[model samples]
Each structure stands twice: as structure tokens, then as C-alpha cells.
Target: MLTFEHDYTRLPEPLWLACEPSGVRAPKLIAFNEALARKLGASVVPDDETLAQWFSGNEIPSGAKPVALGYAGHQFGNFVPQLGDGRALLLGDVVDAEGKRFDVQLKGSGRTPFSRGGDGRSPLGPVLREYLVSEFMAAVGVPTTRALAAVASGERVARQMPEPGAVFTRVASSHVRVGTFQFAARHGEETTRALADYVIARHYPEAREQDDPYLALLECVTRRQAELVARWMSLGFIHGVMNTDNTSISGETIDYGPCAFMEQFDPRKVFSSIDEGGRYAFNNQPAVAQWNLARFAETLLPLMNVQGEEGVELAVEVIRGFEAHFDKTRQALRIAKLGLAEDAGDTADTLMDALETLMHQGRMDMTATFDALTHYAEGFDDIRREALLALTDQPEAFDAWLEQWRAAPLLNDATRFDAMRLANPVVIPRNHRVKEVIDSAMEDDFAPFHTLLSVVSAPFDESVEARRLAAPATDSQAVLRTFCGT
Candidate 1:
């Protein structure tokens, strides 16, 4: 029953100490996430003037503290003791009619205790990138943080260049990260145990009834993350930054900076401008999740039992299941795209090999190649297969690959068309196209953004106007490096 201005002092004790809002410069109103705001049953759209005040730091909402919740993270390969919401502040948790909880926070709001030397503001380009990318991710059935609204903070943020500024009201299951536990664990056993108990009560309430609640929490998070990363791989998503801080305990993908959907099926594809070493490449994601989970395990080790070594041993055993869980989910997705029902005796490896060869040789459009094949077989046209195969240099590879594929029973199934449509999306928010939308919107020509947003919103449909969305970029137009607007 908090009003919009109860002040930070009366919120959570962790957020009690904080500076007041120092309104940002150059504030402007950009976009409102009508869909997400409605999901929260929170309407700020009719109150446009107040949006500028709240986003630009001219006002702080009720139950919100201007505090930057603290945590530690492994940035790239190194651990930093500090990397909180440097430019953001938690506005407390919002609960829905179903009693589900969500954290509503303002990104690019302003500087905080964790601001360090950074300006603590977000640029409009990244704001659009996140809003578009995150919404598309959510619509695609991927667990992701949703954007509530975006407010242009009549300001400029510096990167290599200056740009117009904005703020996003980002909603997520919980802001708790692997780094959150790491921060507590690194501090001491008491803090680690406290965080673990809090997390169990908040996220995995069922774990509270378990004999070893902390270990149960570890297992729960590991399973959720395994399934989450598998879903990403199924769609060719490479989360450029797989830092512990970016790893959410609620299993949703957060920190969409520098993330890219694979243009081709190369397992080694690395698109993040910040990922020079390819540590978080397409194939490396599962392994990185394992690594990050190990960190989580370490945090909960002290709580596994009264004896430390016993606790560590138990956590490691549960963590080992992460790889197998990811593999099972991944293999399920792979076979589904080819209209192959899950089976034991079938060799999915050979089918995957054929797809890989096609991708490597001719840059065969990954989403389209399998999508087209799902409806085609002996009774259909081998010519369509051949024509589609022509898109790749591995026509010979596709030829060698198709012999056994034609023998695959599901290709002839009456419901193959239905299965294929469900397995393959007709569209993704293509990088180049997304960049175009952002660029056009930046110039105040929001027509392109509006159009693409409309098309990409329903990625499974075959809209005549959206034919462009199903196609790959021209060779010259391929965006090689994606950046995390961090």
C-alpha cells in the first residue's frame, strides 16, 4: 500500500542509505512498453509529464531506493569485487494478481554508489536495442527480462561517441545473480548463508522444506540455468557476456548487450565486440554456464552441511548434472527443427552433421534450411530441396546428407508441416535490420522501427510484407561485431 513517494529510508534496510535524485540533463520521452506495463497492470502512459520527472531523476517512486545493490562478477575472465547496478536503482518488488513477484528497476536512471568512474547513463541506441531484443526474446518463448517503459533522459551518454540518452523500466523475476551469492560468500559464511536462505524463501520456496535447503537451491538453479542456456542454443543465441553477474538465478536471460542470434550455424561463431577470445561463443555457452554454476556452488558450499568439505562435495555432485541436462534439451530442440520426433535408436548426430556442412560451405540460412526441409521429401519435390541446397556450397554435402534424411520417417508424416512451423520461426530480429530500426529511430524517423517492430513481433507468421525478415542480410550488410551497451 505504498504511495509513489514514501522515500527510500522506509524501504528495505539494504537501500536505506542513498542520495536523493539529481535530475539528469537533456531528458526526452522516447518509448513506452505498453505490453509489459499492462502485464504489470501499471500504467504510466497517460502521465507523460510524470515519466520525464521519474526517469530523469526529478522524482523517485514509492517503495524505491536510489541505492545500487552491490555484487561481484567475473568480467571476461577476471573477478571484480564490485559491479552493481552502476546506473540503476531498485524500485522494490511488484506482485501480480497470481502472487508472482517481479523486480521493477530503472536502468540508466542516474549514478549510484557503484557508479565508480562511469557516467552511469544509458544511450538511446542501446535502450532501443534492449527494448526490441528483450521483447522479441520474451515473445519467442525465451525467458528474458521485459522492458516496462523507456524515457529519454534529456541527456547524452558517452561511449566512443556521444548520443541521445534514455531510461528503461526493466522488469525481471528477480535481480539476484550468481554474483550476488559470490559477493556474500566472498565476505563470509554468515553472509553466504543469509543470501542462500533469502533466495530459497523468495525464489525456490519449495526448497525451504528440504533437509538441506541450500543444496536444494543449488540444484534448482543449476537445472533452471541448464534449461535456459539450452533454449538459447536451440535458437543460435550467443550471450556475448556470460559473466556470473549476468547469470540470473530465476533462469531468465538478462544483460542483452552484445548478444546476437547466429546468422549461420557455425558452432564457433562469436559476435560480441567484447568477446575477442570467443569464450562465450555459440558452443561455449553451455560450458560457461557450468563454470558460472560452479561459482554458485562455491557460494552455497558453507550451507550444504556443518562440515565444509561435505557441503562442497554434495554441491559438486548436483552441479555435474548441468551438462547432461543441457545436452538432453539441446538434442530435443535439434531434432524438432528437422521434424524428427525424439527417439533412442536414431542418430541425430548425422543429421546435425549435414546441417553444419551446409552452413559452413554455402552459409545456408540456418533457420530457413531446416524449415524448408521439414515439409519436403520423396513425395514432395526433391527440386525444392535442391534449390534450397543451392543456397549452400555443400550441395554435395546436402546430397550426401539427404539420402538417409529421406529415409527418416517423420519427413513423410502428415503433420510435418505443423511440426515444422512450430519448430522454426519464420523470422528473427536480424542484427542488421535491428540496427537499421535503431538508426532510423535515432534520426526521429520511427517509421522503420515501427514497421520492423510490427513484423518481428509475430516472428512465426508469414506476412507478405515481412518476407524481408525471413531473408539473410546481403554479404556486405552482415553485422560482424555486436556490442553490449554496458
Candidate 2:
């Protein structure tokens, strides 16, 4: 049996609305994360039907108190003053063996008061996508929400076409988002302070020791987000929708809607069908994160000890520090990817810039290029060297850069190869592969989905099977745009 705590419910009433999950017709368990369940201290192994019943919201787990969280967001630069958990319910909190609290949520469980005229259901494709991609992100060492289970509703949801429905059970540190504070700020100063206090007590207890806890909390969140965005960039991951509500206070990547990994090296790449202006493009993530943090900062101004323009100046100072935090993390990542020592310094920066320029000009496959470099670093063989060169249209320029990289202050050959291997994944959940899995699952074929999941779970394995999934999509197989599945 799973036990849960109700700390969030203890918060002010405005933050969440008590509700029950709208049960589905027929629930069939499609996936269960046994390893994560064990980590969360769930010892009882229930049968598939029972697991489906609980996860699909047909039978709410004992000790669970479901609620729809309230928050407003700036969606694509437009402020939506009232948007909340339209199709999801927080199924209380769980404390792991290590005593860390995590929010257990059932997404696509059905509608709540915040449904706003839309059906509170999710199509199976998105449930599968989030399960695969979010788990892949966790495996790759990215801080992200985890999928504990997925259950098919055995029914259909209305989209452009009638699509099979599913519910996803997600675990995260907490669901508090920047937009939560925005909603709180609208209620009054005391409500915003209460929300901030709850967040600090739950996520940043260390801030309590600081001279100004609110200011310290803002800095902590800003720094975490900066580093998180930097990590995303290093992996060529684009989080297609970067709304304020999707930005977590705990700094984990949340809401895996319309998200994709970059196949080709393009700074301006945008895969979200709704992102016509390329607002949340691949390279624009860092800036968008800073902008979101600025919004978060606005909500905390009234609570800051310093009043008037002084508090604004202080907040602005912390917000501007995002650039430094991001650059430090990004530089360290680049150095590791290049297999260079920390002391290599400016040489690594110059070399990285030149290589990225070549990649952009050639439209090189980002993951493949890094994998090729990892192989070449193992030993300077003709075949491996040629493989790296093949990814570039300007082979001669790449060849020159390769010599510079080889001669730079790198670690010993063994250590350098090991570093590159760890930094560059052998496989990612490629856009085409994910799309294929979704299409196959829609036809009741799950073999491809399982195969892709297993391959991505061990992203650094250089096995023949992993290499088989490493290739980028061909022109015919490329997925140009992705939908939110709303």
C-alpha cells in the first residue's frame, strides 16, 4: 500500500481546490515503474488490473487527497489570469526512503472546476511520449519529473480526430510554479507571502537561515533555473513550451508537451506547432528562462525587506546574475564534452564556437556529431576520424579544428575518452523514433515503444543496439512539428 501526506492541502484555500479524479470507463495498465516505486517505499506489488484502477483514477489510492492546483501563467507573452490544473490532480505527497518529499499527480484523470470549457482528458500518444521522454531525461542525469505509471483509459478523446486516451502518474519534488506566485500576488500581499513561505519551507529550508529569506529564495530559484537551462542546451533538448506555469520552483523540467530533441544544429529551431514566432526555440531557452524568473521576481517584491525602488533594484541585480550562472554551467559542460581539463580555459571556448559554427553551416546532427567525437577520442583511427568529418559540409575547416582540439590541453587519452563518453549520449529519444512509437501504439503495437524505451534508458551504452537507434531521421521520416495534445 502507498501512504501519502497532505502538506499542500494545509496551505491557504486559494492555492488549490479539493476535488476527486473523474474515473475512466475501463482502465488497463500499460506501464509501471517498479524501480521508482521501490525508491518511493512502495513495497506491495499489486496486480496489473489493480494498478490500472488506482493509477487511472477509477479507484483513488488510500491516504490520497486529490486536488487541482491553482496558478496563472504568461502563455506566449500573453497573460492568462486564470489557468490551473485543467486535466490533472495532485494525488497528495510521498516521502521517499531518504525523506525527500515528492508530489504524486495523475494527469488526464479528467476535468476540474478549472477545465474552462475543455475536456479534461489526455490522448494516449502524449501519455506515451511523456513517459518515454521524461524517463529518458531522468536517465540522462537531467533533473526532471518521473513517470511512475501509465494507464490506458480504454476509451477515446476528441481532438482533431478521436484518439485513444491514457492517464499518466507523475512524481515531482513539488508542483509549485512561478505562475503560482503570480496567482497569489493577485490575491493580496499576505497570500503571496504565505505561498512563498510554504515554498521556502518545503523546497529551500536553508534559505530560512539567511538575513532575507525571500531574497535568498529568489536567488536560489534563479541559479537553479540557470543551471537547468544550461544542462538542457548541452543535450540539444528543446522544451517546446516554456510558459511560466511550466517552470517549476524546484527546478525540475516539468510538463513534457510538444517537447523535442534537436536533430540538426540550428539555433533558431522550433518544433512546437503553436510557437509560430519561435519564442521557445532551441537557443532561446536561456533568455526565456530569465524572462520567466523576472516574472517570478515581480511577485516577490512586496515581501522583500527593502521597500520601493530599493527592492526593485535588488531583485533586478539577482535577475541579471542569471547570465553569469548560466555561462559558468554552460562553459563547464562544453569543456567536459570536449574532453578538456578545466584549465584549458579560453581555448575550449574558441574551439567550441568554431565547431558550432561549422555544425550550423553543415546542419550537422547534434547527437551523432558528439557520438562520433567520443569514438574518435577513443583512438585516432582513420575510420572514426572520417566519420566525424562526414558530419560537416566544411570538412577542411573541421579537419583544421580537429587538430587544434587534439593539441589543446586535454586530459590523458584514456581520461579524455572516458569524459567524452560520459558527456555524449549514444542515443536519445529521437523525434522520428518517438513519433513512430506513438503511431505504432495507436495501432496497438507496443514492441517499438518498449524497444525505444530500453534503448534510451541506458543512453550512454555504446552497444550495437544503441548505435542502431542513434541515427538521425531521414528527410522522409523527419517530424517537423509536434502538438500539445490538448
Q: What TM-scores do the predictions have?
A: 0.92, 0.99
Question: Could you tell me how far off, in angstroms, the CA of residue 427 lies in candidate 1 after the best superposition?
Answer: 1.0
Kindly provide the TM-score of model 1 when superposed on the true structure, using C-alpha atoms.
0.92
Which 10 successive residues of model 1 have the least lDDT summed? Answer: 1-10
Q: What residue runs in model 1 are displaced by over 4 Å at the alpha carbon?
A: 1-21, 43-47, 344-346, 374-379
Candidate 1 lDDT, tens digit per residue, 229-310?
A: 9889777788889999999988999988888888777889999887889899998898899999998887776677546676
lDDT of 1: 0.75
Provide the clashing-pair count of each candidate structure. Answer: 12, 0
lDDT of each: 0.75, 0.92
Residue-wise C-alpha lDDT for candidate 2, range 424-444, written one tens digit per residue: 999999999999999998998
